[model samples]
Target: ELHLHTDHLNLTCSTFHDVHMIRWRLAIEEFGPTFHSVPGSSNVVADALSRLPITDEELEENPTVTMAAVEAAMSGEFTVDMRVIAAEQKNDKDIGESEEREIAGVLVLVHPKSKKILVPTRLRLRLVQNYHDLLLHPGAATMVITIGQVFYSRGIEPDERKLTDNYLACLKAKHPATRYGKLPPKSVEVCPWFEIADDLIGPYGRKRFRALTIIDTATRLIEILPATDATSMEAAYLMDRYWFARYPRPTRCIHDGGSEFKREFAELQDNYGVERVATMTRNHQANSVIERVHRVIVEKIRTKSINTQDEWANFLNDTMFAMRASNHSMLKVHRLSWHSDVTCWWALPTKQIGKRSINAR
Candidate 1:
């Protein structure tokens, strides 16, 4: 019966003239005969034939995930609420509730869910500082892993490229000064006095808040003078009290040609024997260090202030401490200390200010 069926199929094809046999087609069949005699690696037909098709059922039974995906999933699984963890971490009782919430928000975005999220006290402080203070913010994957290494017992890798792309998207609406660029190599050390000076603006409750920022060009150290109106007199006074009082007179100061940095501010710098070097008009890159630091400050304020009673003014000291104690990427050192061990210094550093300072209010 099988032989008859085969003959019938051949008859059907021949009768319909649908199957045409070319003499050249036999050449392919001849090569097939020699496949086994050739090396498997070199035998293209043999190699192709050797591969068994993987069924959809097999794929469904075992899903393959990459290292980056695994880390991202883990980050979502392990989260710690800083409010509950702060006291145990020996953090200042008044570490700014808004700041804690802001930090929590940041950590949560990186880690959405957690299997066993630990609310480590001291460990939390270390992780937060090391991630932010020890180094500049990393991509989502590294940030997750770096924080996870200290807190989670498991891997916490996120999709680094995706996270980075999202972060860049956040900056899309920022001022031109906040755009990304390659940092220039430092030619000279920026001392306490001689540094880049600028002002950043952010939302505080219903009103707008402005901060005077000075950053060491060489070390990437940041100092937040105070929250005040972005006026020349306020800038000069804050610089005199918070800046010049502790640090030696700066050799020079670099700033954008903003009106607030002109007029009285320029005269004030000259009076103190500090040369006023302004960047080319509208060129923020000339003072890129401070410009970058300003973004950080604004983000920090935005994080802590949203839906919280804490105003940006209240958290300036804490924010400044975090920035100063945090590690700088370019200088490869902590602005506040050169020592590897600077423990709990951020809890309450020198010149501790009230939650509401007279200048800020």
Candidate 2:
């Protein structure tokens, strides 16, 4: 019905079965509305809003006051309480006699006899699918609220426990777990405790570039190497040349399960007398140290690449320098501020700093 008033209904999927295509075409012809396909990324508003968690304050507030204020700010229109509107939707038979009626400043058509929400059958499926795609796959509770808003009633409720169970089943089927047969380092002082990896950056300019990031788990000292490719030879050469020259021979080296760290890379590790260890496949928590750093680096890249992403490689050094200078909660010290003479890496507290003549910079 919403699409009927509008010229077009935007869709995310382009292809469908022959039977579905025919049915959809016939529905559009009958309804006098066209369908336009759009990318998933374009549905940002629905995606973000669906994932937004409701606060305790929001739940306790009167819906009439809160919703009216929000609607007034957005559209200069007053709204009735959602509870009142819901009650009317459930029991108001007089409203169904009219072709359309306004609730909270929005016009909706009511069913003639049943007084249920009157939505076109074609749109009903699309509406449900969108809600599921954005909220239900994650088993979020927002689906219930969204259904009420679209259908103009709080009567449409789904079994949340069942939805969550189904979502978990699907998630497990898609990503099976891997076995971890070894234990982690006892403490940060342990040697050969590092995560070496690389990720791809955009096509914002001529071509996409690979960024090689290495981090020492103990010190949190980071090294960023921007390159053109992430091949096994490049990774091996980096370890042999840059890494080996600075640090002592390690007992173990942790590697992400990229093609760059495959058979030949394992041989390179053997040459250095380093036992190669791989992180659990597709598990971010297994390599959380590097994963956290990757997020920060990518965010910085996006922020600093306002003019052109061609020069993102140039900003890597400054970004990495800042990250290394920052304090780490785990280590209890600034990552790069440690000296060899210092036995303890614990940073001076703010209260202690005031009593000493310290030059932190």
Candidate 3:
């Protein structure tokens, strides 16, 4: 045993003298005044104590959990709330989203195993900041980084290409000067069956009819199901079936808080076992793909006097194919490269030309 105080209650050097005296007298009395080996260390005792978990490795691996680490976490000495950043779950198809997050790009992702948040490397951050300033949003400062060609950050993915291009088009759009602090997104790629983004596409005439579109973030594939009524409960039931029939039970689905998305989707979390992520309201940057699609509709929709939804639907059939073949600047692949929708980050990929030998000569 290690003792800091003596039994006699002495406060000074007197205790040290008394302790040495007692030890000597006891040794002589117990050992019959004979010389003997004096053990300087207890190897057995040290080994037993060393077997307990006390290092960071032991704590992070989550091996045999100890009450002490738990107490430390509870007391705020160790932040063990790691469940929030386990990795952005993926699906069968993977993508190379950026390294740093854009505005409103916040979502779940695999965080650094050692820290709560991680940002793009210094070089990458500088590169993105420069690209955005010179080529697009001059005030835009960062881009997301990825792990093994994939990842996620905390905010949203704006039409970085469009924003930049539009600014440069006229060099005078009187862009907004306001800015907001935001969470940094993590680098990640998509796999399959873990993440999904869905949204409703209507209010055209306000008869309460809507189209609930859910997409596999990994494959970039889309599933559009029409909801007869625009209520949340009805949309939820229909979407649940559409999701379960196609996916292998997803972990999370992103949506808006529109009355359709908010009607108790979480309780379904227990039944279907997937969490719901609602992007910021009035913030289309988070759901850039769909919003961009809407813009395409707005720009290209002919004001022609074709007075039939049936005729419009027939013509719209070709829009999907056209958008798919076009390459996207952000994802660096055609919208159809992985999924069926017409969407991309930058201007659609430019078509290349080839020359042929003239036969007339």
Best by lDDT: 2
Q: Please, what is the TM-score per model?
A: 0.46, 0.41, 0.37
Model 2: per-residue Cα lDDT over 188-249, one tens digit each: 33322333443222323334556667676545666776655667777676667666777545
Point out the higher-scoring one by lDDT: 1 or 2. 2
Candidate 1 stretches greater than 4 Å from native: 1-179, 182-194, 200-205, 306-310, 339-361
| 1-361 per-residue lDDT for model 3 (tens digits) | 1122222233312123564554334322221222233233533554567597688876557643211111100121222222322232222123233233322354533344432233233222333333333221222222222111233333323433344344432133212321221223644444445677877765443232345666666545555565566777877786768777755677778776677777455566557778877776545556655654543332223221222445344323433333443344444454454433324322233221012111110
Q: In model 2, how large is the Cα lDDT of residue 48?
A: 81
Number of the predicted model whose TM-score against the real structure is largest = 1
Judge candidate 3 at residue 164 and give its lDDT: 39
Which wins on TM-score, candidate 1 or candidate 2? 1
Q: How accurate is candidate 2 locally (lDDT)?
A: 0.48
lDDT of 3 at 131: 35
Note the Cα lDDT for every prediction shown.
0.47, 0.48, 0.42
